[model samples]
Target: MSFGPPPSLYTQSSVAADQRRRKRRRTVLLCAVAAVVAPALAVGAWLWWPGTASDDAKPTAAPAQHRLDVRETVERRPASTQGVMAVRLSTDDLPPGEAHEMPGLWATDKILAKGINRTLVGVAIGTDAGLGEEAWKLRLGGPICGKTRHVTVENRTAVLFRDSADKESLCNHVAFVDLDDGKLVWQAEFPVSGYVDKPDAGSQWDPGVTLTHATVTVTWGDGTDAYDMDRGKLRWRVTSREDCISQGAGGGRALAVRFRCYDADDPQSRSTFEIRALDPRTGRSRWTYTPAVGVKDVRIISTTPTVLATSAGDVGITEIISLDARGKYRTTIPLQGGAYVAECTDEITYLATEECPSLAVGAGQVFLTSKEQGDLIHNANWIIGFDLKTGHSVKKFESGPNTLLRPLRMSGDRLLALRESSDRISPMALVSLNPRTGAETPYFYFSLPQEGELFSTTEFADTVVQNGRLFFGAKEAQGPADADSKAWVWLAFGIESAAAKKP
Candidate 1:
């Protein structure tokens, strides 16, 4: 086809190449415009959206001016022959008791730390003549076969204890007393049945509390109830057969409850869970939701009028369920490996796993521990972070393997991780980890002596943080074979305000 107009094959080929080039250029230009316009459109839509509290909520103000000031470390040693069980702090200065003998038991002198210009309160039990009787007799409530189940402070006026003396009693009883005068305020017995074997039914044992506008929502064995603290009147009660009851308070009148219902026969039956919301004043149900099943040990990690239920399923599956204000299911997220869900905030949820503890939200980040897993013989434990909004892991920090991770405490931006190790002979260390960056700082580390063979026992009275100061108390063993080895010491540490900074 070398005809005159054959237009050299080369020329034709060149023309086709030119057309291809133009098409590509046009495509590039269009792509460039789309890229530049799409983001702009999104920004415009976001800015134009009506301003709602959920959208325009102001950023949390920086933690008020505060410091982690080490205020005091009191070493309280009981008398020579006495063993202390529970120690409590009161407003007045009380005399220490001397060891004495009673009808069938030995008693020691009672010791009370008083006259501290703080709302600090502590309680301890002792074994000896004078002290033991005084300590045990204080009886906020209980000969509770097990340790006291719950202790709550009420406006510095009274301390409430929920304890059980006999297995026949289904409901846990409550006792209130003046913190300053040690005067009994009021006591009431609640009956719980259905879950446990006992005469009293419907009363809760391990009751959780959330106060809203003078109303306290108590979650316990059989259901959720609201009480008016000021009037000391029962407002209303809702019955459900869930095992563990947890409550979260937010805003002024909103409250959320995490109800756990498990199958007695099938461990996997533990998956049944529900998060309910109600009006704190009227006790009217606002919303209810059944999150996905397949997990047991479901707990209320945290909430904001919203409920976040985290469950540890069979094998190594962990799931997080978010319920909206209407108690409707918002989303379900499956965590890699299995995780022990701790606390959840508006921003993130903290998780701990067996192999590696890390945070997730967008990208998974691992937290580094001061000690290595290999060094601890694969005992190193990690505290992982997960972003609440994105459903991805964010960071992981090392919380030593021997350490028992307590609940996550939020102070401003800093997330507090409390861990205790009972492996050591004396006292255990209370470590504080930065949840955001996975950096850990030791808060208090001490130990008490054991009665025989030094079987590494450490007891933490309470971990409370107020006004930027962390108050941790530990019971140190007096000495080997000494029943009096259970004296307590309260350590107050002023954490660097920076420790509270969010990651």
Candidate 2:
């Protein structure tokens, strides 16, 4: 999905806020130095050095500053994948149309959507039936015009869509629509910044939206709020505690949020890391965990209901630190070959690049990606499985050499990995690996529209496994412009991979 900033947004106020914050920070730093440094020096002189030295010997050369000790690549033992079948899904050769609109030159256009969502159809081979509606029509067109910017499938029969009413016009509302009749079930106007006017680069404070159990929990730049599914009423609202800042936060299917809290003054220091679980409805803390010693801070890699996966370390050296449901430490997987977890967030903060998440949480295991020696040259990535209950290393699976692999969503109990095709004429492929047995099924292709050179670099985002089907959105270009505009594509990788027609 297009997780980057919109083409144009009114960011002058945001920029002014930053300037004010910088002034406050400089004032605070100067006060902190004056309050502590002079007292500390007097104490040191009185106790340690009672008399001043007449002449000091030549000072030894100062020690070199510490730099991030990150290795470019690490080698790994190859693992075998046998007894798996390669499968590809049919897209019906449907292409997307323009989803973003531009009104004028001075005014920014509000009709921008990240991507569309469509269901995966897995029919039997040679028994193809036509789709009820054009896939893009199912997600983008029809009742909604160019003003609609965000649309998410709430359930089989309903969807959540946000239009220009809120961010662009100050009447922003996130409305739920019944898919069968296209009627608004309810709509909510969040308290903070309206429907995403722009995407943040990456910051501790940003917006994250998730819907579960007919409840919508939104964490925006200022605070977190939860709304009832029906009638769109506020259930709970919360702001961060003093001296602490709200970092990245997200929720799973269960509607529970593992919100991150960091010390505002020193986000990179030893005491900055903190994590806690919140009951979305109540806006109350359920459990909390703070790592001790040697770890500077904690970043969420991924999480399941029972397991929270994260990477902990100082600088680039990191170890996988998993915690159980109660927020107790489960196990610490030490730095394996000096590698850290690479992560990316669906709700990217403003001005931030994608994150490097170290691991992903799966059904019965936590999945970790490790770089082979060839990863530096090509996309040779591997997956390592750890038992969920015990947090123990279980198995390793490889997607062969000279190919890059990315962990997508889990289908049933198997972990789905996207295999980036190396051949110029070939499209990307998909593989499924049973986390328990380390058995990988190979080579499933999506009949996506071929965009020539852009197809190879096209990245998929907002991947969700819903109603036994996989739905994800992709954008050829991140944002829309009057000069050059592109539409969004929604690909549904059907569960049934029979002999389907190629694109």
Candidate 3:
């Protein structure tokens, strides 16, 4: 399914006609609502909102706590690369495969693997599959550049690459291969010229990924494309004026995408932002909303076929907008500074900002962090909580200066914040934060070999939290002062709640 702008700009007469048509539709919908409201209002007026209190209202029990356990950890490295790098995880434990080397190396570039432990897909300058010396490599028809921006796993069957084939044109291609055996299943290419940028321009950003039951949606900057994973064929293409920024799958068998279109005259300024929800199977527009343009830090919070959008105003004013079934403005709620929202349940929303602010339909409570005045410093770190619905600060906690906190995952009542020293020269530490109480408890701190000296250029890879354990990989290289560094090592750590305190 595809969508595009009108063939040409609308004339004055056309604009007036569209307005009249929309206005008439609104009138009919309003009349239909009024006709049914008289009888429904009597029963609804007496029913209290789920979270509110009433004389007959009774509190529901909290959900049962699930224990998180670390099952296993296996380290895999590519051949030729000195660093034991590129670790992919799957649900089942698999043997450590031989490391494969790609053609290019960039600080921001990454290798993706499908599944938990098994090597389902791999891509670099060319492509390869399987494990160890038994792995097979396939040479693409053309010289595969290492500068590919976004590579995604599709339907556990194929890999998609945003390839820059020429100086003026950007092309998207997919390589479908068998997951068990390294065999080419199929390949398709789409050429795009308008949004293409020079290699040095860096306008090509991360592409969006949305996988439906039947098709996988791959949205590039100014164009949207879908692939029938089962058949390995192109479904449709939708081109737009702006770069598609984000996308999400809603419950009502619909897919939503957001994009920003800038005014051509003022290239530095954006003129409009649009959110469109489409039927995933047919590629038909179900609803569209074009909000005011001043929302500088717009981010898509959630999207459902019935409930289309949730977004923040900007970094400073944390106001969230929610759209209704008709693609019309529904409600707006103020959020706290640095508030982060995540989809917790199908019907409820969870937020974990500085501290942790949460809300739900039947029951909800706010968790906050606290600190002392002496803890304040120019670069000091702290975490706080606020009420998501009310925008009120609930609590605050001090984490000390030069401390970096990365959220691994949240499970049950525990919100794990991986704490490490900002000073790359020092050892790393892990800290756990409780979302319910705003308490930060240091879990484990480990030191690397001081003589080797930490590689300042290498970043401590972000940690992943699953089940109940935190996983992280660290890279270190060593060499003579004047010579190029050759010695490299990648270390994986599995962290769990400590049963006994260390002396």
Candidate 4:
């Protein structure tokens, strides 16, 4: 959840998902597949990308098609990292040479990212999302300034962002934006001052929002506020408790909230965590759920239309719990270990494991990747899909088995898997599967140039999949961090043409 913090920053493990899926697969077929697939993927890596001399030692087998096309090359370091140079080309069909360039001012500054209508705002590093609709090359007006965290998309038409460049994380201002172009619909400041500082982690908590089908709710500091999305006017505001400070909140559900109330004076006093659901209209308490004894500071893992997913534990163990909208316990999915994987990613909250996904909630189900609790990556396998109604296993699939095959996206009907390089030695691939039947189909694949290495973990953001495309950012190194210096490359892969079988 901290993503540990990438000013140019943001980070998944899939191991957990593998074990959960393996438990249900009592069959020898899946067991055998798990035993063999990973090395096979690694063995196959050299075929996709050219590598150092070692790769050359092996004979090359020509593949049917090249996975990706280099439309344009990014400039370098600061320019490439800032959101300005990000949207150089929109996905929409464009002229042969029209490309976007960054304003020199943003080279060292940070850029926030948010995805909408398959298009990205602030950061459009490359057109991997697609290359036909008209590329989204939006430039931020000089008015909005912030170390750029992310834009909270309220709807297809508008987005909200905290525009304070102050690293203190205070909310001096917020910008309501139009998706058609990078135009500010409205920019306003919170009536009060300071956004609480999570100084221990070197991060700030600004107002977080929740949007329902009709209303908008935001969590600023210790309280909640409601706004009219169309007019940008405050409808209601709830001041936080005098003794309790609000630590975190979540949105993107049904305009509902599960706010964290902590000791205002000490902030770190997590001995007790109070989760309350607030009325989106009046900011009044609708319901509150308190953790049972032994489990302190129950934190939200994710929220869905049918359930509120959470994690809590006593010492070093963490357990996943699900509650209905009314805050009634549905069931519990127990997990081992602590310290969820932190990522410098946008739009994801739960931490994943080394081999499986950390967690996914959608389509009336909950998903989790187990930690490397017992075995390491090469041996761990399974991904569990749990019923949101009973918190029981709905289905299990032999996730990556020997491979780091991760569920990158979970929609209402299907799950998309992206196979990535683990040691940076394997070639990355993508596939899609039916959560119900476990049917697999090759979606796409790409190779890193043999000359470069994957970026440092801190600069890496998880892959974003939408509109038949995959968008990923990586920091490349010619040497070490101080060596040839650091540069970034954003990869966009169009998967529409090869969703059925490998080309």
Candidate 5:
């Protein structure tokens, strides 16, 4: 989606250029200072001390203090759920054309970064009483094909995009971007053999990327490559075998690959799936786990805990499998009989192998949302937690009628849930769910714009919480279904407050 900034905001390109110029000036000044001090430092002299003063007489500079951002302070003193709109981005800002798929959402202390159509954009996260403005934009050469939901501790992430704008172009380019300043730190292209025109064709698979603390992994159907996150240098490569095709990879605390193999000579033989864990640095196999004969598809829920979602005869996910750190089977939570909702795929497109947005695995529990229960007038769901060891339901958090709760991610040890807006009346909320008691503590509550109805359901949207705010955005931005009808579509929005001060 092409987004135009509001009247109150500056264009991202201009702001980014100005920031770059200032950074260059600072670099030059620092270099000049070092040059001036070079000769004095070679004399074995204490430059800052008085004549003949001993080395021990020199005073040591104090260490820099660490300052907390707005988001950090909010965590210390829980932000009021009663929040006002901080920023609202709408698709209506630009002329409507073909629908665009938006994929990635991330936040830093001062800005919220998102992948919109082909461009990565950042907007200021305004205070409780103001609206955030556009900060910067980094335009990729082509639409983003895949991205890593994992952000490094220093706030860096990776993205995969095509070499050109042509729809049939191969998604061969991978890059690491600095989320803080919207800068492309490094980018490199990989050899890809496939067809973007036919993603379902046997030749098409890769086009995926994932991140660990030190490595950025990218897969393009036929092979997988790992790169140094800082320098974009290739660390290792794994190619597909004649019988087993490399699907893709997932990474966070650990790295794993999904593969499919079949007997080419036996036409009636069934194809099998395998999950293989790899050493993030060297691409060496750590262990491999094979599912039941009938399991058709497998997805990674968490690499640290080694949790997976698998599908059998049906199209939807059938089981949630949890494995130990050593890849041993620990438990299987069944989803049959419509008892739970852990969908890994949608009608339009397949999510990344590890991008099960609604499901969370942490704190010795695999948390999932129960299927919505109620009639048209009222509907609700439960955030159910299943023990990773026993596969038994242990904790549950319920929502009120007309309200739905979905797990976003784990915050420290607590699971964070999004309390979706209800019937256009009750405002949406961000709540912290206690892992032990299933009790909730509100982080904040805020409503979206009328054009933001698309965010009501996060199934197809990306939701991220950082600092102390919640950012919810649409994955698909399109015009009204009917060409003749007119409807304002919102691209994304943010909720935050400066009013919640430390008590």
Candidate 6:
């Protein structure tokens, strides 16, 4: 079944697995010894960066151990709404010409890395501590076709790119890049045949790549291959059956593949989509789960819990399916009406893993944001968590009438949400929500220049909350409308410091 487009310029959310686990563990430990966290402050007068008191706040290189301990820092003064290090990236030094589609964005304790399309080729660019300066750059041979949000403990991740600068070159090359050193550790190329350019006919069959702790798996046209994460040596290979085609693979703590099989008698008449779990170290199938017969799209939410967002006969995601470790169906949460929005985009067709932008799964619950209730002046929203095994709404965090809450990332047992800047009267803030107590603690507050505010949304840019800072980077940058005119395209911007200033 064809969902829509591939994971191209519009793919929304992605996070490295290693980074998440480390932060989760650190957050849990920090909360145990920290003092009681304070509540958020009242909304302050709209204030922009630079040329104001907020300008005095500067970005500093955070200590290594404090990277994931953002909760502890906020507890000292949780209600602060003052700005700190407000770094805005107007445009980088990359040769300016036509617009470029910037694909991936990842962050570490010391640097923030972004994917750039430099003249049709893929270039990985890094900045030191949100300074907006290029610390290093790695030029992939061609435009990045796909990438895995999972990173190894040593800060290594994989990316998929084309073989040459030719626009028609298929994305058949995969490489592992070291984020800390900004170096390409290893790369390998696989050949794919009988490729189709149409979604319905199987353009989603393009080679896809994903990373696990010990393995990097890629799906060629007909089958799948698993390689060692450190070295590019092939660990195991699985060829597809004569009547089946492997769509792609997704990985985290475990690996899973989604493919379809056709009837031997009539290839066009029969179709069945299946998802199978494979051991990361070896290529053995552990369990398989098949959705209802006509489920058109299936996106992997989390591999460990085996959650999937599926659309049956309808267009967008109609429900969320939870499965047990043994592949047994646990529960199905129906989303037929417009009460809740998971933000699953149709453009994420190929390697459709990790595509649910507005949903977070953890602590035996799947958290989702409720639909907005009001208009521009008084927008209302809330985040509700549902038990994965019982499909019951267990927790709810409201976004007061002035702001809307969007889940950014999960920290330990808490969920980090972006409190959207409602209007010129209010500023955007970050808060951590507790599933157990329903308590929300404010992290920091900052506002973008009037012109730079639009890019702050997750749809227009990529977001990263690290080292007690929140960053928003453009997903794509277009050149000047003409040669003589300039465009207000922001490459990236970040907010730090949560210490409230005297009102």
73-173 per-residue lDDT for model 6 (tens digits):
12222345554443333432223367676776665545556777621121122211211335667888887777665556566677888778654566778
- Per-prediction TM-score, please? 0.50, 0.55, 0.48, 0.59, 0.79, 0.78
lDDT of 4 at 254: 36
The lDDT of each candidate is 0.35, 0.39, 0.36, 0.39, 0.67, 0.64
Task: State each model's C-alpha RMSD to the native.
Answer: 27.2, 22.7, 22.7, 16.0, 15.2, 12.1
> Would you list the clashing residue pairs of candidate 5?
71-467, 71-468, 81-444, 81-445, 206-220, 206-221
lDDT of 5 by residue, 14-78 (tens): 11124465456334432332221122123212111111111111122222322210011123224
Residues 28-55, model 2: lDDT tens digits: 4323322211222232222211111212
Residue 376 accuracy (lDDT) in model 5: 45
- Highest TM-score against the true fold, candidate: 5
Error of 6 at 21 (Å): 47
Cα distance off (Å), candidate 5, residue 149: 0.9
Evaluated against the true structure, the overall lDDT of model 5 is: 0.67
Alpha-carbon deviation at 194 in model 5, angstroms:
4.1
Best by lDDT: 5
Model 1: how far is 230 from its true place, Å?
Answer: 1.8
